[model samples]
Target: MGKTTVIHHAPLVGYPDDKLYTVRVIDGVIDGIEEEVEGKYINGYDKASVEEIDLAGKEWLSPSMIDWHVHTKLAALHSNRLNLSNCQSASEVFESVKQALNDPKYDTSLERNLVGINMRNSNWTDEDLFSLEKMNELSIERPIFLLYNGYHSMWCNSLALEVGGYGSSLNHKGHLVEQEAFDMFPKLTTANNQVVDNWILQESKKAAAMGVTEIVDLEMEHNIVQWQRRYAAGNDYLRIHVGMYTPHIQDAIDLGLTSGDDVPHTDGLIKIGPYKIVTDGSLGSQTAFCHDAYPGTKDNHGIYYYPPESLSEMIETGLKHNFKFAVHAIGDYANHLTLQTISKASSKPRIGSTIEHAQLLDIEKDLPIFKDLGLIASIQPSHLVDDRDLCHKFWPGREHRAYAFKSIVDAGIPIKLGSDAPIAPMNPWEAMAVCITRAGQGDEKNPFIEAEILDLETAWKASTSNGKTRLEVGDRADLCILQSDPLKLDAAGLRAMKVNGTMLGGRWTHKTF
Candidate 1:
């Protein structure tokens, strides 16, 4: 591939003390950065051997965003089977599934077909997974599998259930099951290991268009192979950090994979992230483990998913293998327990000990503990707007710390943002809008959580290229040249921000749409 060169002229953000400066690029790294310069082209390589292109002063050159948690192909993987997140009523979900049977959008007869669908709590029932009548109704002339909002749950139609050997199994309510069902879920889904790999590469390009230079891919046990294959394919458009789910921690350790182990691209491109564990369910389902019961509930603290002692043992096992923990703690109690577990499991402070969704926090106390404990809140701000209704209803008296971004920042914990795509869309700008507006446009009935509101810079910092820190001298030249400066744009304007061009590793990966 030929190296494309460019001279950029936008004021750079994220310099020490949040200063702006000018930068020049050679191949894929920042060759020079200066403040108050009288114009200098510092070309190091033989000028005769390099090709150059000028920016024409139309683009705001900035490092791309880095979404720490997102599911790519898997985000839309089951659209053909069922979709829970899209429908407000059970009939809507059924109609959506019914439409997939005859929708010309997909060539349903193709072998190795993958369909993405969404389902909601209202649409699911105990026997839905084994419903032959429903499968017949939504038949797309091929195997079909439906994925739920949490991404952990899967509901297979009769054809999929039969092929995956789960047609007769009955152990759990709705579509959720234990290891057996979880294992079967992936097989029944449209995106097989290989298909998923291809889709992620395509999705990664979309992310690159959004100026996402880096991503922390938290792969499920079955996705490790897909990750390896995609990385080996040599499309280094985005620097990726791979993570192993907790169920695969032992296998990863056996295979000599630990936190920070490099596999492809640069040393940090494909490293293992925290050992991921889901401590509780989500707020939408009213299953987030909380200290206080949900509003309508009389006497339940939700489910703990994993017992404290078991979680501790798991932490100890992970620690022995030099793995950092990425606990998915959505509720206040779940968050508190995960924090306590970390305190007891490890003596010395460990970096990258992230609490996913730290959504419902006790900010005044929890924020400081996270700061002192060195924990990162791997948050998905979009969840706030999507789940606002349930949040208000379920979180009666404890609405204070819900989605408390500003307080969390003030308390001193580094905040990393993500799309959590299958639950929300994979648009950082959408999240940015939520982070700032805290309201879902024109929804007067829904108000922004007062304490959670963040300033533009903080919101920008949490989602932009600086969000992941990739603007050093020798960093990958993955960046987006925007028509408008995000820093200068309003919250709603952030979503409409034009993509002038995208450069991944110094190559023009995508041009303006």
Candidate 2:
């Protein structure tokens, strides 16, 4: 028989506030849950072997949170790599790179290239956008690659451009956008497998402490093999759904892998996730394929990666293989086009077809279509906290439709919240807080769009798996125990809420008790 455990005085979420409940777990599955009776627990088990935990009605229990979209490898890399997220200007970015070059701490690394991530060029002035001449002035011997915050653009020095075979494609400002930027990513991010693995493990523990139980890792690499290797090396703290990029779609098909299929040798902790495709760029990069032209441009409508017919064909092919689709569509035009493409790809409703970053939408037109087609909207609310000013600048009057969480929910569309980590921090509390307040943490009064703010309940639902609002019997014992009642908290309180414990498969992954 499997191990049995009993939890007493558990304050179950969504349950009545008056009474605390007792929960029973057997081999990572919830067996029973009922009103707690004083000292009346542990039935049908060896008294000595059955472990018991008493919450004393002090903690709140809810399903473990899920980050519906993430690039795990990049997130892991951010821990050790140079972070330019805080640099406000292009000159500041160069100065930081120069400082890193002179710093002895960076010289100890085995990595030959100077790789940096999370630079927001949108915030920089046009005059600050320097050319290769400025980069050359640094006299850097090693290749340098600086990634844009949204992962849609890259700024590389001459050495880096030549190394990535992007010398001929380099623009005046040494910036690469869309496909060129994506193609150069591997060159910049390459490191020893062991070092990468260690980074992943470290990030996993951090995620657990933040109450994350599962992540849909949409890293732009062959994730199956990467995860298999990690699992074999004993990294199993969090459940992972490994997603594939378009380039590896055929590789997955050849291996007979379908979405949600448990990966071999992962101890059921890893599963093959959706076939992910980036149909457009991001707002930060100003390449998010919108309907209206950018502020200065006459007819430039951002970048659209795939033609409509081609996208439809791709979806149709994946659908025939029993693979679920996750397309990245951020701008209004991109979202509209992707919805239409997915709708035309199949006559029947595609159950698990999701639009990742459905960030911008044509509310009147797209909301009804999104609901009717049974497509899920995977959004990252924390993005609004960062992109609120950018949206107003780039999207102008369409700010209301940007990150329209409540509007989507009101239109009866299933919405999932995520961090889009490596872009935003992977904190569900932050995401939930932003969703509820439509403002950044501690800045709750100045909401971006008051009409689109989500309620605490709706935000909580979006954070859990399949929008589960409450814990139930027979569910997997993947749970998060909090120090305070989340429902009673305001936006700031939610953001500051502390996790007392986290349980995965009936075992504690994080515990303060």
Candidate 3:
């Protein structure tokens, strides 16, 4: 292998192939990977006056992680908003609001439109509206929105409802479910390009620091334009795979865009990806399209957003234009219809469609269909732990059917793990830990559906790509150096991994080396 830059004597990790290698790179592409042989090494470059990174034979080199599902722009939006992620109770949520409003940094301008995220009040009874009473207590003069932990529902103040052109009587107090909330997201999250771009840039860098080098952004807006602008502004730390929202597929088609089209005004930082179609609601909102109704309600079978026939047509149309589907289906019935739609589509998506959040499954029946359709399960392991209580309260007796990660893998359907960004966190380490444990790091819920727990090796392989991890000849030189080998450590060690540095195409992105 001949190269201009050489990483000498590094203990290569990840990928099933090689263990120790001196990797050679030429202009960000791997030229050759020479395995350590005969207790010696090989240098593909001039020894003297040539720059090289010596690993000292102690550091562990791993392939950079790829998050298969994320909403890059919205992640930034959520991060910039008033964060309420760890507020376990309703009072804490209100306290957080009071604290944020009192802070001098907090802007009270009506135009600012305060919004909070990651709120979970699972202790509330089913009869509870998860009302906006607390929100209105602060002040109804300026609009405020509080998004539920699952993005399926949100509670807003009276002013927010009024401004959004919805009457207070339209929903429970000021809460909007499913379709209404999703529709409100684009309108409520208005901000100048600079603000959004800055936040996105900040979040992307943070991901690099956490060992992620690539993300498939399933943003609700026109992500192509957003990424183009961001990348043109000289922000190219993360390799973004941009997805157009389901409603905007026509816009992409009108602009003559295809699935693999490179984003304009960027140095290969962005590429077109799937068409995101959310077919069902979430368990948290009690709107997942399940075969049985929610625990308390008799006729509440949950809403299937679109008819299967129409949904299949959309899939076929996307495939006609060479776009895969990242279908969001959380319930058993939703997963059922999604599979049937993919199987019945006139043309197959080039890379095949994936069922996003394939959360719940009717194991005996769905397992075969998963294998038969050869679908890709784009799942998040963190959801299992998060949804544990929701499953108990809303989906009693069927808890085993939810977040069935191990079963999906055993059924031979390919799986890719991700944080789902704002919905979960974008840390792959956390995702791997939760997948293996079926509970969060240090969580005491006793591993919901413990039989579904995956081993560390299984979880890691599912979460990362062989292409990124393996030191194959002529592969992209994207690597991450860790202070310790992940495989050698326990679950906690993996989640608390010390990222020494990150490299993209043989160049350092986050370096402490």
Candidate 4:
């Protein structure tokens, strides 16, 4: 921690355009702020201050984005976990795997299996996890797992199944969907605590570069222990709220956990978060537990991982342990069921909950329920760009309902935005652009659900914390100093805007200054 540090003559974001202000901070907390005088700025703090970074040339300063959902480890777990994000065909996926096979870390032995991630196959002609079948192309000889882009499904070879202790439980071989993937992913990958902790820090630095100061990591394994260790090892770069997977709820209760308890001491950098429960599937996998059968599949109503009674019981039990929820729902039917279960079990409990995704919402039918219950809407706007084609293909004739951002906002619900990183880019600017433009990165001509587009102010408020005092005289100095005005920039400019610095509690986590 340092003495009073001043940011001089920077345009304060989310405010009137004509004024520039000098801001001061001390010991990781905001001290005071004063507007510029006669086209000049003066340091607000004492002249005896230890240091000052002149920001007279800086373009803008605003609160750094808070990512509501991210997978800390999956962002970049290993050097060999192939990145196939934009791949369009099955052949591209196989090529990436083959290319990654060149890494000396992986060998031909089935015991030392290979894994790849972010391959999308829904729009491909083959629509299979891999191009070849029956472990052909030598795919069967060595185990390999190609995770889908949305992480709703996982495709693995026969050797992967046998080597990972899952072959005996199944009669057939195919992509593991929803709960199977949820339960089996950690098993398939070799768990290395140190490797994962280091990976989490490296990924956090990438997020810091994007002007993000806080993130909630809802990765499906036991996250508390890993985060605790990281903080103990002095890896605190940005604030992290580690979430508990529902299967580990009892473990959390056994440990006497509360939402904001620190692990030894993280200097307020680490906190406990809500319990994450995946109650539904995703549209890309054609298993979102929809109200009607998808146009292409027969008798495919989709899958509900939780029965109502069981889900309600889980919520009630979690409430007993002072835990809130972040329930996953992608389909209309799933949302309806989630609301029903929450409504039935939510009373007499004091913790708040958010329905994650809420992608395919029946606004007219569900908005009232959400309003009456007073729940938070944790949405990922960037998913719209990636899901436009799939939404139309799988959830046909529901263009208006899919990715319904405007409807949810208009209903006056509290909105929290995130990237669902690794699933999406974790870039706040790109997320904000897609939120306001209905356009994907580098593809402005194609807009999905044009009416759902938001204004820059609203998008910024949703993407970043607007602050209780709006960065007044005294506030926590979490900020992102940029080189351009977000409101003045177009989608491309916004996406490409330069981040001069990012501050987590008045300390420069990532800074060019």
Best by lDDT: 2
- By summed lDDT, the worst window of 10 consecutive residues in model 2 runs over 166-175
Model 2 agreement with the true structure over 419-469: per-residue lDDT tens digits? 999889899989988888888866889999999998889888889853688
Candidate 3 per-residue C-alpha lDDT over 426-456 given as tens digits, one digit per residue, 9 for 90 to 100: 9888888887778877773568889888777
Question: Number of clashing residue pairs in every model?
Answer: 17, 0, 0, 0
lDDT of 2: 0.85
Candidate achieving higher lDDT, 1 or 2: 2
lDDT of 1 by residue, 1-513 (tens): 245364534545444433345565666676666653455444345556555544545556677777878655455353333344667655566667666556665555433443444455532344233444565556635666655566545555556666666445652222444344457645654445566666667777777777777777665554455566777775566766667786666666777877778754443456666777888877765678888987657887777777778988887887788777778889898888878777776553358778889988776656766777788888898888766766767787677778888888888888878988766767788778777777775652455676567887777777765554336666667777777667777766887877767776677778753
TM per model? Answer: 0.85, 0.96, 0.93, 0.92
Full candidate order by lDDT, most accurate first: 2, 3, 4, 1
Q: Deviation in angstroms for 390 in model 2?
A: 0.9
lDDT at position 110, candidate 4: 22
Choose the strongest candidate by TM-score: 2
lDDT of 4 at 259: 64
Taken over the whole model, the C-alpha lDDT of each candidate is 0.67, 0.85, 0.78, 0.77
